[model samples]
Target: MPALSPLCLACAAALSVPGAAWAQAAPVTLKEVVVSGSRSERALDEVPASVDVLTGEDLDGAQVQDIRDLARELPNVSVKRAAQRFSGVSPGGTGRDGNAGFNVRGLEGNRVLLTVDGIRVPRELTSGVFGSASFGRDYYDLGLISRVEILRGASSALYGSDGLAGMVAMSTTEPAELLKAGQTFGGRVGLKLDSENDSRGVGLTLAGRPSDTLQWLGSVQVGRSSELDNQGTNTALNSTRTAPNPQKDEDVSVLGKLVFTPGGGQKHTITLEHVDKSSEVEAYTGRTTSATSGSVLDLDGTTDMRRSRLSWDGRFRIDSAWADELRATVGVQDSDSREVTHEQRTVSPTQRSRDVTYSEQLWQGVLQAEKTRALGGDWSQKLVYGADVTVSHMDNLVTGTGAPSYERYPLKRFPETRETTTALFVQSEFATDRWSVIPALRYDRFELKPRNDGLYPLDAASLSDSAFSPKLGVIFRPASNWSLFGNLAAGFRAPSPLQLNNYFENPFGNYRTIPNPDLKPETSQTLELGTRGSTHGFQWEAAVFNGRYKDFIEELVAVGGSMFTPADPLTYQAVNRGRVRLHGFELKGHYALGKATNLRVAFGQTQGKDTVTDRPLNSVNPAKLVVGLDHRLGDWKLGAALTHVAKKSTSDIDTSGTPNQFATPAYTTLDLSASWQVTPSTRLSAALRNVTDRKYWEWTNVRGIAAHSPVLDAYTAPGRSLALALVTEF
Candidate 1:
């Protein structure tokens, strides 16, 4: 990694001046905005909860490549990489896998739902019934992203079930003002060169307006990365082992959007997007001990994924006595992933093969209307009503020739499942001269069904179930610069198809799992209070939250044998569990030091516990902190950031009463970047990550090797790397 240039350092110092602080003041007037969480457009100050908006400019200035990198700049948001061998766990090349998951206020999985143009993406499946799979943190080509909006805290009141954690809405690019004015079509072409990773990539984006009432935008991006190498000699701490040569990947995506308006009415837009990615890599398996020799197993695999989406949105005004605005949206998404695995010993001569495939389709429709009227003197009221429906179907298949000969069953089979949900919600906001109040509520009904295709006749696999969840919240503004908000929301998650119909019975006795049709839905209630305000040169936000979970569904490990034979067999099945609780706090703020400089800091911590056993919940995140400084002068901009992650233990545990714990030591990393405007229409930027090149493990995971052996080490996240690119628009 390279150090910050001398000129950039001087700019940083100048921006730290006291006079620069005044720039932090909030504007006195409010602007109308359409946020995804609301049914219709409204004033930002009138929203009931904390919301953060990151414009495209912010993304460009920060050199953000994907959602994971963007998370580092937000308050109370943390992204952690998982152990090496776990890389292939995630279905798509987007990078969510076992190593990548985002924690907001310390809750992850289905809790934090992600959406693009209001379409929901499916959650990943894990051993626990909790929504642990995170698709947001993974790599999605950012060349088409125009802006990102984050709504923090429980939002079941607006988004329903998956909103137990929070929500992230990603908005894609639209025709720019220049293009709409017919001055010229605007576009950018750029290439990135990385030093440590020995990788190079390029991308292009273009936008234009065809006529006064119609606009169009399109983006295409493709990138290929070379194999990544670790930095340390100790393979255990290295980002990659075996001379650092296995991790490599490639990605390509194209997005197009069209906007239309009937000369001065409301706006209507439609979008079509497609993303395809494929990658192959070899990852380390922790050291293993054998009767003959100690060696690691090389886990080699290939993965491919394709995703497409179509959506339409319209905003119109209705001249009615009660209603003033109406907004409607309809969307559909299709995704597919296929994975192939080949395992071999690094030192010996043997090979094994396995394959798995997953396919999903989702359709959704939404309609919302809001009306604003004068309630009384110095008071105004806005009422919103909306309804939404979603249907999703998934198919999963697993096969391999690796199963022991005695257990050689059908080579392949498919398990199918489906889920549907419908919801209706309403919210009201009232404002006075110096104060404002908002109250909102929603009701949701969800249904799930699964059927067995006779793959396993003995596993009675047919079930249907449904659940209803409700939510409430309020916000108050006591002063022009201060706001207080609190919310109490309930969330529900129905049992998935895999938990109800999929079953495997092995008479040969190696491993087995039986579906439980009687599984119940998991439910949770959350309470939160927060405040945001600005002072002199500083702006800040602080929040505290707590949640209680009931009927949590968890996978339990059971040991058994074939009914006709005596053999040890490991089995896992879903089971209803006792209660669980989580509590956390978050703080983030920015201070304007002087004319050209600014400082930002954020911190978060969370603790989770199981009521039944009085034990800590697995995968709970440790405390984390991030600090950064930015400076801009004339045609140059420079920035630096440092992130610190506290030490935490892995979740893998054995029966010896002694836990198989691995401590992930705390580490701080420094990053520096600068952008130089070569011309008014062109710019060049370069950035370096992990400047210190310090070796550290990201997170822990289970290894297939013997416990306590050296061969059991998995790969760590990437080490030091540098990237540079150029952009031009006309």
Candidate 2:
């Protein structure tokens, strides 16, 4: 990819002024919309935080198919596929099990919380109980999403648990004024082809609203992608080689949603949704030595997810002097995952063996109510109270030709685990003519219970804890076009079930992980300051933040011999560490050259260090920069963007007999796209990703590969791929 030329920088600077025009058209104006901030419609400038809104039109113009693709265009965000050597899990949990995780300002995984219509989705996990390759199975189908709102920075004080990093809220289509007038339908069909992987796939989506008070959206997609063959797979670690020419894989997904609203004086709404995904692939382990041929493995997996929600919202006027608006929401989610694998030996056909089949079910429920009141004096208060409960059951069934054919290993069913949390939060906004002060507080109590179903011997059955978090912020409007803000907040995360109950093997030898029943919750205190403003054709935002973490939870290696009747060789455990400090900055802005052209740029950097070790934290993120140019003509729109990722240094570890720590090299990529209005109600578009076919490792997967690994030879990022689609509405 070509570097940003000095001329481009000069152009950007010159275009930053109000009323500047680069072509024969008027400057573009910022649209006024409220869903980006508060639940109620309010101007974007009224919100005191780092927020970005991507409109439905923007998504269509970009040909965005998944959340990962959508993250690339957002400010201070990065998304990458998971490492191949790391076990087969879906990349960045697609908002499920939390495996395929997304990194923002260096924070990844559960640190960042994702929500659909205010409902939290579970993260996906690996068979070993680690965060799944991606968060959840593709629960986020772009076809059903009408808009997306991203709020960056710590928000745990307002949202419980998983909001420590930030929050991503996706809003699905509903039957509002935009669709209530008449029956409307729309759909898109597209195909993509890649050069390096020789991969090909197609996708389709359809949605419609038939009545004023009802809307329904449904989508189904299936695609086949060729295995990524990188030369770097020829490495050996502890005599265990990586995979080469890994078997290709297939993915299928289905999503449906129904939304209903009553047109009575009393306001009420309900939504029901379901999502499913499945994948199958053959696995290949790269050759250990030059003389040995690789092994071929077979694997099959399926994930089924179901969610139902019923909510009611209404307002009551107690005397005309004051009024109160109330909202109550309740939801349930059922998720199940199953996987099976078969390994084939290279030397003897009969030497084949199979590992145990793994399966688990997750059930969750949430009830919440929020009330807003008008308190006369330009002062209003909002109170929110909620309770959440989740139950999970895990079963490990040993099945295969190797198992005793007659007396199969008894199904090992771990005790069912249950988690319950209740929280009370309040936020008040008091404003004068030119300034606003917002103060918020949240109190949360969490309880966990583990039931032993005769699967494994465990003594402790339950644990509980509580926390109080607070936030204070102020926003000042120095001028009508400018605003300045600052905030101080506290965040926390309770231990997840897997973190407290998982027992797995280590790479060293026959090892086991003992659960730590006595673990403290992780907490962080953060301070942030920022400014935003818009003038005619120019809009800009910048923020700086610092945070301190306490009782940080991390996986620790136990030195002593395993403690078991059989006395296993090695052991590992989860422990609470001392403290960590992190700080970062984010800057994003856009300038309209004219009605026909515009330019936008965003950049972010974060640094985290352990107070005790005085070293950078593991997987700390690197700096990132994205620049784009958009142009429009008669019924046509075009865009080109360049993204740069900085190098990252791994955390320091002294015990490593051979330290595998190093810094990832920086790289850049380019993307181009175009969209055409075929008719008043029809549109067509195309996009080219990795335009230069440049190879680079996303920071998240760098450690899984070898040193000096060729970018293309590692996990390739859809090299030089092209996609085209058509959409029509009536």
**Number of the top lDDT candidate:** 1
Off by over 4 Å in 1: 1-34, 37-45, 86-99, 127-139, 177-184, 195-199, 227-229, 232-245, 283-299, 343-352, 400-403, 406-414, 452-468, 556-571, 649-658, 700-715
Model 2 regions more than 4 Å off: 1-41, 86-99, 126-138, 177-224, 228-258, 264-267, 286-323, 346-414, 504-510, 562-570, 649-658, 708-712
How well does candidate 1 score on lDDT at residue 53?
76
RMSD per model, one decimal = 10.5, 10.1
- The C-alpha local distance difference test score for the whole of candidate 2 amounts to 0.58
- Candidates' TM-scores? 0.84, 0.81
Residue lDDT tens for model 1, 1-730:
1233332243233212232112222223335464754645555555655667777456772356555567765656656544334322222122225224456665676667777777876665543211112222242566667677777666666777677667777777777632634454677776776664565667777777667777778788887775554543444322234344356778888988888887545888999988777767565432233423424355566767778899999988664654566789999888877666665544343554556666778999988887666644675666677898988887765555454354333322325667788887766655566565555555666666654554444444554544344444556777778788776666656666666554555555556677776777776777778888888889888878888877776654463554444475666576777577888888888999997999988888777777786777654666778899989988998989898877764432222233554555677888888999999888888888888887665432322222463422334445787777777777
- Candidate 2 per-residue lDDT over residues 1-730, each given as its tens digit: 1233332233233212233222222112224574423344446776677777877667773357556777776656755555344232212211123126566655666677777767666653443333222234345556556688787776765676766767778876554423334447655554544433444545555657676655666555565555453435445331243333344545555555555555543344455555454444333332122334433343222333333333333322222212233445555555444443444434344233333333445444544444444344554444334555444443443333443222233333224567777776555554554776666666677777776655444453366887766666778998988999987777778776556665554333456666778787787777889999999999999999888888877764474565542455566667787588878898989999998999999888888877987766655657889999999999999989999888764443221322554456788989899989999767888888888877666655444444553333444344577766666654
Q: How many clashes does the backbone of model 1 have?
A: 16
Scored by CA lDDT, what does every candidate get? 0.63, 0.58
